[model samples]
Target chain A: LAKTTQPISMDSYEGQEVNITCSHNNIATNDYITWYQQFPSQGPRFIIQGYKTKVTNEVASLFIPADRKSSTLSLPRVSLSDTAVYYCLVGGLSSGSARQLTFGSGTQLTVLP
Target chain B: SAVISQKPSRDICQRGTSLTIQCQVDSQVTMMFWYRQQPGQSLTLIATANQGSEATYESGFVIDKFPISRPNLTFSTLTVSNMSPEDSSIYLCSVYGTGLNTEAFFGQGTRLTVV
Candidate 1:
């Protein structure tokens, strides 16, 4: 498993774009980057995932640099409901099976009204 | 996506007692996992519940402490035995969706508070 580092907390106001970066210096070639959001008293929800370059969905955008050592999750027009903890995980197929995801201390996003 | 239902969403238990958390998936899945999240901490993998055979636990977690059972493809249970105040946390059950780059679906989680 690749270890990830992220900020402990971030603050933003409504309508502002929030970007959270995660560093995984020892990322493996087969590893894929995934981001999950967790609200209070709830399970983590899938935000976005990407192997390289950029991937976008209606909810968020994932940008992986060419080196693939780091990735950023970009949330557009944030709202108060966007406040949650975000986790970045790096894992891939191991022996023909998906490796169990190991979560790190996530970045807590606090969206102010 | 799979739907998971966990019984007894929240509970307050006394020390030395045991609590069994049940997880049921709407459809059959090949893999089921149990995780624990301590207060103000990240989630930790407890074990991977394998059907028919014994579950494979992660480091620092033992079968005696956190026994897991997967009798079939859609149902599993995790028993927290001989609980203490330190055992208070949220337990979540998860399963992998179909495909190579599939996402995992998780249950609402069981919030256990030991007194």
Candidate 2:
């Protein structure tokens, strides 16, 4: 399993773009970086996933450098509803097989007015 | 994306008792997982619920303690046996779709409080 490190917490004002970076120095070649968001008392929800470069979704954007040692989840025009714990995970999707999906202590993002 | 439904959204169980958390997916999936999130902590994988076979548990987990059952492709259950106050936490179920470029979908989660 690739271990990830991220900020413990962050605070941002509403309508700002918040970028949370995750460092995975030992990420495997076949691994993909994924981000999930979890509000209080809820299961983590998938935000975005990317192998390299950038992948954008309706909720957020994932940017991975060429080295793939790190990735950043960018939330654009954040709102109070975006306050949650953000987790960065590195793993490979081997269909039909179970892989150890390690979740690091996520970064808690508090979007304030 | 898969829609997962978990039973007994929240429960308070007596110490030394057992509580079974059920997970049901709207579609059949091959990879189902059980996780535990202690208060103020990150999610920890408990085991892999393999269909028609014994579950593969993580290092700190065991078959007798966190027994998991995957009777079919769409449903699985996790039982926390001999519970204690320390076992109070949220248990979650997640499934990875077999199709390409798909990600894992999670159930709402079971909040268990052992007293």
- Alpha-carbon deviation at A58 in model 1, angstroms: 0.5
Each candidate's number of clashing pairs is 0, 0
What candidate 2 gets wrong by more than 4 Å, as runs, is A95-98
Taking the tens digit of each residue's C-alpha lDDT, what string does model 1 give over B1-115? 7899998799999999999999999988877999999999999999998889999999999999999989999999999999999999999999877777737778989999999
Q: What is the lDDT of residue B109 in candidate 1?
A: 94
lDDT of 2 by residue, A1-113 (tens): 89999999999999999999999999988888989899998998888889999999898889999999999999999999999999999998665565667899999999999
DockQ values for all predictions?
0.54, 0.62
What C-alpha lDDT values do all the predictions have? 0.92, 0.91
For residues B1-115, what per-residue lDDT tens digits would candidate 2 score against the true structure? Answer: 7899999899999999999999999998776999999998999999998899999988899999999999999999999999999999999999886554436778899999999
* Model 1 chain B: lowest-lDDT 10 consecutive positions: B96-105
Q: Which lDDT value does model 1 have at A41?
A: 91
TM-score of 1: 0.97
How much lDDT does candidate 1 score? 0.92
- Scoring model 1 with DockQ, what do you get? 0.54
